[model samples]
Target chain A: MTGYIEKKHTFRSWVIEKLFMGKTIKEYLKGLITPFNFVAALILLVGVPVSVYRFTQGIGPSTNLSDNNPWGLWIGFDVLAGVALAAGGFVMGTAVYLFGLKEYHPTVRPAVLTGFLGYFFVVVGLCFDLGRPWRLPYPMFVSVGVTSVLLLVGWHVALYLATQFVEFCPALFEWLGLKNFRKWVIKLTVGATIFGAILSTLHQSALGALFLLTPGKLHPLWYSSFLPVFFLISAIVAGISMVIFESMLSHRVFGNRINHQGVDFDKLTLGLGKAAAIGLFAYFALKWVGVAHDNRWDLLNTPLGHWFLVEVFIFVFFPCLLFTWAVRKSNAALVRFASIITVIGIIINRINVAIVGLNWNLEDRYFPHWMEFAVTITIITVGVLTFRWIVNRMPVLYEHPEYKEIDQ
Target chain B: MEISRRKFLKSISAASGASLVSKSQFAHGAERFTGWPERFGILTDITRCVGCRSCEAACNEINKLPAPKIPFEDQSVFEKIRRTDAQIYTVVNRYPNPKPGGPAVYVKKQCMHCDEPACASACLVKAFKKTQEGPVIYNKDVCIGCRYCMTACPFYVPAYEYDEPFKPEVKKCTMCFERISKDGIPACVEACPMEAMTFGKRSDLIRVARKRVIEQPDIYIDHIYGEHEIGGTSWLYISGVPFEKIGFRMDLGTTPYAELTKGFLGAVPLVLILWPAFLIGVYMFTRRRQEMVETEAENFEIEEDQQ
Candidate 1:
């Protein structure tokens, strides 16, 4: 009875705060008119219409996708690259929850939030790319293709999105000022974390397995039997690097919102950088192992071979070395710079596997049409804006003071 | 509980630096279906092909496809290489015969319809199917139009209706599924004036191809294309010149693409089984520590109250 009354009172109070939060609401609205929002608005302006054009006119007009090249930047960048970029959730969840690293708690909620939003948009982009997006459920509820790697990808991503939502519910409950609901949600933390970790491991690798059927089509340098393993390894670094990278940006952009005294973000960056250094080092070693196992030494002599070297040495290896140097010296700025390169390396690797490295010998290379670029940029812009909105509204970046004991 | 950088590095490497898995030991799970033993198939002898477009015209008429801009009787259509599209399910392309004086060789290309079709394996909705009669058929009602089958097809046979805004589908050769299953031959086979194409049981066709190769070693290539490529296809080819010279990919291995992904899929069950137990154990350990901390905090508060 007391719990019911308390919930009702808090619900009423929450409504009052939203309707008339005094200058707080006005200040947030005023803050939205920055130069950054202008660029985002401009992208949506063009991109929204282009997406509408794609739907009405068909994928032919909006994309450079051909019978020769069925998949383009939308699948390559928006879905594949976006899913990888969102790896921070499982990586941090595993580090803090499973490994018992209490020091990493402050970073956990943001990582989970990033992951949920990232996957949510991957589905959005996937729906756009599909010819009949409405029938997507046929693979799930209607008729399951047991042998399909893509089927595994679809089911696992859907489940993982839900799991991440549940994993982040404590923050949501607190935002709603539902004390009893928040306490109920906190009890589900351990199960949800484990479930998220399992799904993360599967779907992350399943995305790579989606290309396994196209072994002859994907370039020899990229195609390997160990693609799933490689994807999982690189995703770990992608996750760690993304957290280090995102938190650095979050600290700069949302400086006032952060509890700077409580959480020393500089130290956090260096710590995350240390973990990423190890992952990147392993990822580099494994990539060569894939090449050697495939006996692609002859490919190293070709022009694409040189390009592969650039991807490895410059983007992957150099950032790894920089991470080590930064961690050893506790150079937060250099670590931040290395994280940016690591993010770039992840993007290049995904694009290389999906686009450039695929059909490398074909005469006609597929370059995304201008509209394709607009759609991809728009999807990314929407993800960023949504992330900013949640961070501003919810208890994502900082721990809610009311529930400090539980979350902290 | 300060974590030493060296210990953390050791753990990180131990986790992500596990031994690399090689393809040599990997088994593609194609053993589940050895394929219908008595399945019917087509064998094409390129040496006998006359570069006539009668088969193409017959296919267009029988499938009720849109009429071609260049009528089938026009010999000028063979001036350039052509690919099959939504309007046509098959096309014959002329290539210069290896010998200088002989007539130009013509090759008819369509869906290979593998014994274990990759399209069937890749479709998440089970839209593409390999039938008992050997034709790779499709169920349009179940298809989500993801175009993954196009990516999976090594032959690049499947085409899409990019012009259709609302209800597009994957268009490909059905190997005359409607006609062949009903005691009738494919329209293309019946329309072949030179009698270059032969259709029969896959095993019988292989033996027939071997006999032809042995009888005319000088005139035909000893090896039959698609006999073992991608774990054998229903469509077989024999040509006097090298298969590669006429745009055939010699690189597609005998190991079926389905088998290639089985190793990854095989590991999936193990992960799903092991992850929960391991994670829950970790969760228990972490929860125990939290309980201890809570109890210690409670004791400290009681001590303060006594003071």
Candidate 2:
């Protein structure tokens, strides 16, 4: 209202205009009750109650995690996979603000938003899984396990979540029409971005470092001294692929706003696909080197070895080739397909390290109980709803009119 | 998604540039960690063991843990291999004897209480500690029941009390800490009628184990099991049969499990220090490039106005 010539609206009118999309509240709720939203609603309806049950009854009743298998779906998907997927913030922040890639400027905000929401929801999932999650900050404040890799993860994630929030504060400021706060936050962006990158580097690798102590338990195929490096490299692949996958979905779902914003989705997809191809290729090569270094050649004859090969060939190498082909041919459809594969491949890798490859010789392998899946689905649903709610009104999908042409 | 070959090339360079910037430590590392000097430990001779469950009973009674389903005198319980669980800190597992028509050799299984315990290193809150007294003890008050110790332990000694819904703590043998700290023997050692186990300084015990092997090389397999396994566990065993044949993991090399993450953890400070400088340097470099482009555009516009 102050920066633009438009008049200010009362709170009720503003809500009606922005949230209700100038339609009646009844109409807005009717529009929201689509098949997808109905499914999302059902998931949360069952899942939230299951989460409550977990807190009261403990993980024994809710999860299939045993002493033989201490971690299950929640830790693997929510913490490990969630953190890896959220690497987009650091990747895009560096590309746009640090590396002088001005063309990717349109993606930086959304990438950071995606990263912020991903991490926020990861913490939500951790609360459900952690026994006595209220003591989560004990590692940071109360006591210290200086030798542990998990302490590193705990501290880094907490600090990085704050750093990512600060990095995205400019969007929140603009959405709120706080001119001075927005300007100050824009100035803080570079420092916040740098700190976010630093935090990401430590924790991303630290996640893999967590499994280093479980030498014989985690299958030798996935276990190597190179675990931290492999995790870091593959997280880059996850970040790039997720940005592609996310933008594809967001552009289609928020069609009119994206069209109005003039985001060239095709160009961004090809550019991200090219970068992912190179990153995935180097990571693929790293995996082979890891196998050779560990001298696990004979392991390939076994079933576990064949499973490892499937992960490498079909998921890792296949996507690498497809992305390369997609980039070379400028085939957006193939690029999109490869992006999905790359996303799934990253999830597979995290699951491999966290669960499947772990305790490989156990007589009874652990599986996630239905309650565990329900809680996980609930967290994702809430995260998506939050993302949609914010993106609808914030300057994330569209540039702030007053702040236009101000390069971040 | 539009990119000229130049920007595409720039991004290829960027991808490499990003990889170069992270600078991960992925080197293979294997190092032995001999624990504290003068730490008390156990030296058990497997040949003297008669599959007696006296040690198991002593451990359970000393720890005040719940009673086992089968009494300690019930030898039928040993028919199948058993693992130490929440209520039972130690178990006697029967293995095939080296000679024909002989009593199966029994290996007393409990926490190896490794010199550098992986569980202690893995706990996020310092809930577990390798005490100078030679036992790896856990703090019930500090434990958040993450159960990571169970996962990191190569021996799988730490068993979680999953049934304890309110506050669960890992259950494992504490090496009879209460008794040992008082200059008294562990309950198991006291309970052994055959005197199969010896308790003394770990260094002295190792020498004693070595002497037994040297004196009776034929009877002793010539290798002190825990004296070398995983950088020498507290509970040493000199067995007449090969250790592996008696459920011991001969595959566990002398390298301590804690050494596995040494290189990775060593690089933590390096990342914390190097990353911010790298990030800021890139930011300044990019900002300068943007300014240069803008200045050049302004100059061209001025030149056009003059024309």
Candidate 3:
């Protein structure tokens, strides 16, 4: 009876003939670069030149960065904001692999792949913003300033990228039918997950630690010695929120495959929503402690201070409450909406620290130039292309063919 | 299970030693020295400054820096106080109304070499160093140009040579280490015709500043500006007017800037050691559930086969 049911499901899926199943490698490659590839190619064609121009011309000419503000939209939005959004990968990886939650195994590959691509783009964005791109390795090998938060962040990002790459390799191996190689890759899963978590914790917090030294320069409301702790906790919330958001997006975009594969959205969203709720609660408490510890009650009335309050209340506080409500009610749609808001709040908080909060006393604020925008968009576009390319080729978005009949 | 037991034992050992590690982590046994001893330092006396651009002129000459748009003889430079930039390492700004009815106070703006300098602490490559004589200097040869020092500086003194296409370095007042090491005063200090600048031991300069303030309390502000600011700077300022009027950031707290990252820094090793075990434990606990599910599936398959 079980064999009969499996055969029936296979026949249903087999209705769409596998045209590429027996095709030559060359033919497959030729057929693979479709209109989507053309769009991606067009973006790269325009983006590469702009990126080259930025590289040749100094950051001063390429961006609207001023002496008053060292970091601008590129650093704030692209690197900082992008990294926080990518936190979903590590959070989900930990949930399924580290916590042995086999039920979440389906989401793990997609989450890890997203993280890997997100960090890759962050590095690309950093290269564009870096004044001396050639001297980038000096911080890693030559100088190794152990004391600087950037040094810690740089090392962690570098290491974590490698760890994420390793964690995602099994999917590639499985897709290629390299069963022996997949076993070796699977052996690395536990170690890589742990290492990735540690690196993520440090680097996520280190982003906030970068602002700790700028106590007087940064607005009092945002600057705290415990910024690293705050950032780490917020990253937990942000990561869970990102996973929830991405899962919904993926569900919509690949509904045919997901539904055919029997992807469990309800259970996944509930688990992610629970994680987000806890993270948000911790994050809210830490933010309050940051304000109270610093005795910054008077700052709340000022305009910049009011903006900070809004960031905390409207974005952070509201989404947190919404996330909790969604989790209790098992409202996947509400959880999805709250996750998007939570992600936005994380971006706002990062920008506030890296740019908005910086030079708060200055009347003239720094803004990004068109060239800077072009370069940042180019990097993000590249990331999206890479993500699409991987998802198309790897088993990240679907269950393994061998495991399709296995009941959970 | 074997791995878990070993990890549990390792964590127990680590937990037991946590107190010891915490103590050794921050409790730097008291040495009177805040940083490198015998460090080269600069001493600036605000009372002696006469708003002359001689030090500015001398610095340009000695460093072989670019000639200013306005020549040294231009007293009009006093109308606007200037900051150090890519081209200039030191600038003397004129502060009016520091004392009502008194002569306008001339304040030399430069890097205040602190006892525990934040810039040095912040530099990743050890490119910026606090020489034993009290001067915080940068080595361009080893510099990666990360500019962590620029952000860490409380005084906002470190300026990057952003315009330089090839190799840009952090430009700052080095307290004239090259000349001072040879027992010569800084070019700026030596060129002060009004004897506004004094070059001496940081310890001696503080005493000299206090004595001058005591002798003529009516002529100067009672407080010595850098004496205790951010762990006491090498340059001591005795101003006739308030320090804030002259672009001094008085809000910088006394704690050394590196103290801020100490919490996270101390936790790095702890996290490095513990996170792997913690995560693996979670993996094991989860794996057990997966195994149970697999077993249940196997039993269901067997029952279906029997039927």
Point to the candidate with the largest DockQ. 1
lDDT of 1 by residue, A120-225 (tens): 9999999889999999789999988999999999998999999999988988888877899888888887788888899989989998888899888999989987
- lDDT, candidate 1, B114-191, per-residue tens: 999999889999998888999999988888878888888888888888778798888888989888899888889999
How do the residues B1-307 of candidate 3 rate in per-residue lDDT, one tens digit apiece? 2568889999999998896676665566753446554554556777678777888888889988899998888888887757787678888887776456877777888888887778877776778877777788888877765566776777768887666645767788788888888888788888888887778877777778889889998887788888778777887778777788878888987777777777778888998889877777777777788789889999999999999
Can you write out model 3's per-residue Cα lDDT over A17-70, one digit (the tens) per residue? Answer: 232444555676787778877876777887888777776656666777655566
Please state the CAPRI-style docking class of candidate 2: acceptable
* Model 3: residues with Cα > 4 Å off, grouped in runs: A1-46, A256-260, A403-408, B1-33, B287-307
Report the lDDT tens digits of candidate 2 across residue range A94-121: 8877787878888888899999999999
Whose DockQ is higher: candidate 2's or candidate 3's? Answer: 2
Q: fnat, candidate 2?
A: 0.67
> In candidate 2, how many Å is residue A264 off?
1.8
Task: Looking at model 1, give its docking quality level.
Answer: medium
Off by over 4 Å in 1: A1-16, A19-31, B1-32, B285-307
DockQ, cand. 2? 0.48
**Candidate 3: share of reference interface contacts reproduced:** 0.47
DockQ of each: 0.53, 0.48, 0.38
> Which pairs clash in the backbone of model 2?
A266-B1, A267-B1, A267-B2, A268-B1
